[model samples]
Target chain A: MQTKRMTFPGKWLPFALLAPQVIITLIFFIWPAGQALYQSLLREDAFGLRTTFVGLENFVRLFRDGAYLNSLSVTVVFAVGTTLLSMTVALLMASTVNRMIRSRSTYTTLLVWPYAIAPALAGVLWWFIFNPSIGIVPYMLEMVGYRWNHRNSGSDAMLLVILAAAWKQISYNFLFFLAGLQSIPQSLLEAASIDGASPFKRFWTIVFPLLSPTTFFLMVVNVVYAMFDTFGIIHTTTQGGPAQSTNILVYKVYADGFVGLNLGSSAAQSVILMVIVVVLTVIQFRFIERRVNY
Target chain B: MVENRPWANFFAHTVLIIGVALVIFPVYIALVASTQAPGDLLRGTMPLLPGSHGIENYKLMWQSGVSTANSPPAAKMLWNSFVMAMAITVGKLSISLLSAFAIVYFRFRFRMFFFWLIFVTLMLPVEVRIIPTFQVVADLKMLNSFAGLSIPLIASATATFLFRQFFMTIPEEMLEAARVDGAGPLKFFKDILLPLSVTNIAALFVIMFIYGWNQYLWPLLITTDPNYTTIVMGIQRMTAEENPQWHLVMAAVVMAALPPVLVILFMQRLFVKGLTETEK
Candidate 1:
């Protein structure tokens, strides 16, 4: 909210500067969000002839609906799976790369370019790698007499989507984890080492605790990412198939609204998603403000 | 200087090697697969080594995509992606720069309200409100056009905030000096503020370019026309075939991912700066 002490005296210029952004927001963002709210309260028949006001009915139906419940649970599992896998791998890689001062930039470059791969492209790459018939991973699995077919098995599909999503996210989490690791004061590590603590002990007692704020921040971000941003991954690979195994909430919103023609339900789902995003954004901002102090 | 452990250093090196291999595995496979002939891929497990058909497959995909998928050639799709990404990057950067300049330099009425309105966009991603947004685009007849692809998606709160934060750190004396030199608001912004913003703008352009290029859902919904398909969504179309030609598909995938990947590799510092600073 802070502005310059010496300001430009302008009445019309400020409005002119703001017009383009405000216009786009009104048309694309605010208007549609309003429409979603309004449509959530009305239901149309299959013929699209009559619409009746059904206050809270769409939301009430969603709570009762088994499919919606299934999607919610799937979203939670997917989000948790992605956050844990990516963050753990990133933390390990970051700590390892942090140790090698000479090879740090080289390893960072190799590790970070995957951040540029689109979620859809990432999915396709993994799909080919895990393609039950032709993929190398499956061939190796078959050597162990264990089959890996995402096309038929629900768990396999879930695992495949999770892996694809996690793969794209590792680079992002790595940079943050590396930044967090670098920011930890070296003197503390030396003090712990001088106390005869092992490297593992020092990491757990000193280094890990200091990285908590970054870890927490990345957790919220990764969860939000998995919930909303992995739509491309799911769409390209599973299409929410293998018996709805990979239908996260965002994908379900698209499916229900665009494909199923269930306007009221999809609108209601959109409103719910908007509320969830607002809450998550608020939590993230609050945490970030606190992290600034650290 | 507290201690030296050769064993620990060796262990860290081994871990880093394994980590890098895992990170590169998928792309390596895609690259290898793209070089192989269709017959080789269909015969069972794919070969680990690059095949002799590398140039052939890439040329085929670029010149004419899989006719079975009814998708346009990879060349056209890449062009569309480039155009869309550039439009979005330019649109977002220019508008955000102006608005941030306004919010920082001018004391105006309803400023806080407008700021909050822009901030509201951070929470409402297009995925949540897909249908209504689609309807709005449809009603405005923006579907299947560049305007539909980029404009609706360009009102960015993150970019504006990034510029605003950067602008806040500029010394107030610069403004006072400009005013003493008999400079108008527009003149100062054009001369002083614009040059100071160059680095931030470059960094943000890299990030936003990647974001705009990699968009999947928005283009998919708006552009039912094959002519307007981006490479990202175009890949989906190719893969939707009953038995996709893995060779050509991989070739298309490589081309689709190359630009942004190269941008990151070359401008990594700016990309990192843009990412870390924006999130804060």
Candidate 2:
């Protein structure tokens, strides 16, 4: 609510200035969200002809549905898997890159451009690379006496989607991790080293602990990303298939609504997702405020 | 230096080189596959080296896409994508700029309410509210048009907040000077504020261009016409076929990814600066 001390005097001009964004927000965002909430409470017959007001029935039915429960757990596993894999790799690369005096930017450039690739395209690229008959990965796994195929195998399909999702995200996580690494005081590391501690010990005892804020922030962001933004990756690679193994909640919302034509159920799912996003956003903003104070 | 650890330096280099290679591997495979003939991929595993069919494959994709897939040629799709990305970027920047100017420069009633209304949007992604939003757009008859492709996706809180933050850092003296010289609000906004905002605008433009270009689901929901197909969405259609034309698909993927990648490479400093600032 802060503003300039000497304000512009206008009766209708400020209203005019604010009109476009507010209008678009209402038409596109708010109105549809309201509709979703409204539709979640309404149930229609199989003919789509008769609608009955069934308060919280959709929500109750969804909790009792097996697939909905499966999707909730699938989302948690996918989000956790992606966050752990990408953040670990990113932190390793970032801390190592932070050590170089020269050639640092070269390595960073080589790493960061992957962030620009669309997730769907990234998904396709990985899907091709893991194709059972022709892909190099499956062929290599064959050499190692392990069979790999995502077509019939649910777990393999899950793994494929995770890798594809995590691949492009590493670049984003790496950049943030690198930034976080750069901000740590070199003197702390130097003193730790001078105290006869190994570099590994110094990192765990000082650097990792210091980087907690960035780590926690990235964890929230990566979770949000894996939950919502990964629709493209999942849709492209697995289509949440080999028996709904990869159907995270976001994809399930689209699938059940559009493909399954279960409107009330889908609307209830959408409402649930909106609630989850709101919770995550609140956590993020509150953390950001706390970080600012520290 | 910490006691001259030669092995450690070598170890760090090894880990980083491997990490970088892994990052580059998928795109490299896509590039190599794009260059291969159909028969070349029929062998047991994909070739690690480039094949001779690169030019023909790219030409075929750019001029005419896969026949069975029914997707338009990459040329049309790329143009559609460029137009869509440009429209969204311009639309988002312009409206957000005006709104941010109003919020920061004026003491207006209901300003806080408007700000919070916009803030709530950050919580509601298009993915979550897909069905009803599609219904709204369908009701409005905006489906399959460039406006439909861009408009609903543009109304968010990030860009507005970003502009507002930038406006706060701007010196108040500039505004005072404009006022003392009898310049009105619109004139001051146009002449002084717009000039000072070029760098910030350019930075946000780079980031938003990539964002708009990379959009997949919203476009997928609304745009069903072949003419409206973006290269990103079009490539997915190609791959979804019974027997995906991998060669042509890879070529289209490369084309789809090229512009945004080039933008980031060229304007990396701005991209990074804009990204860091906006996230904060």
lDDT of 1 by residue, B168-277 (tens): 99998999999999999999989999999999999999999999999999999999888898999989988889999999999999999999999999999999999998
lDDT of 2 at A196: 89
Model 1, span A1-294: residue lDDT tens: 789998988889999999999999999999999999999999999899999999999999999998899999999999999999999999999988888878899999999999999999999999999999889999999999989999999899999999999999999999999999999989999988988999889889998999999999999999999999999999999999888988899999999999999999999999999999999999999999999997
TM-score of each: 0.99, 0.99
Candidate 1 chain B: minimum summed lDDT over ten consecutive residues — where?
Answer: B1-10
**Per-residue lDDT of model 2, residues A140-207, tens digit only:** 99999989989999899989888988888898888888898888888888888888899889889998
Task: Supply the TM-score of chain A against the true chain A for every candidate structure.
Answer: 0.99, 0.99
Q: What is the model-wide C-alpha lDDT for candidate 2?
A: 0.91
**Best-fitting candidate, scored by DockQ:** 1
Off by over 4 Å in 2: B1-3
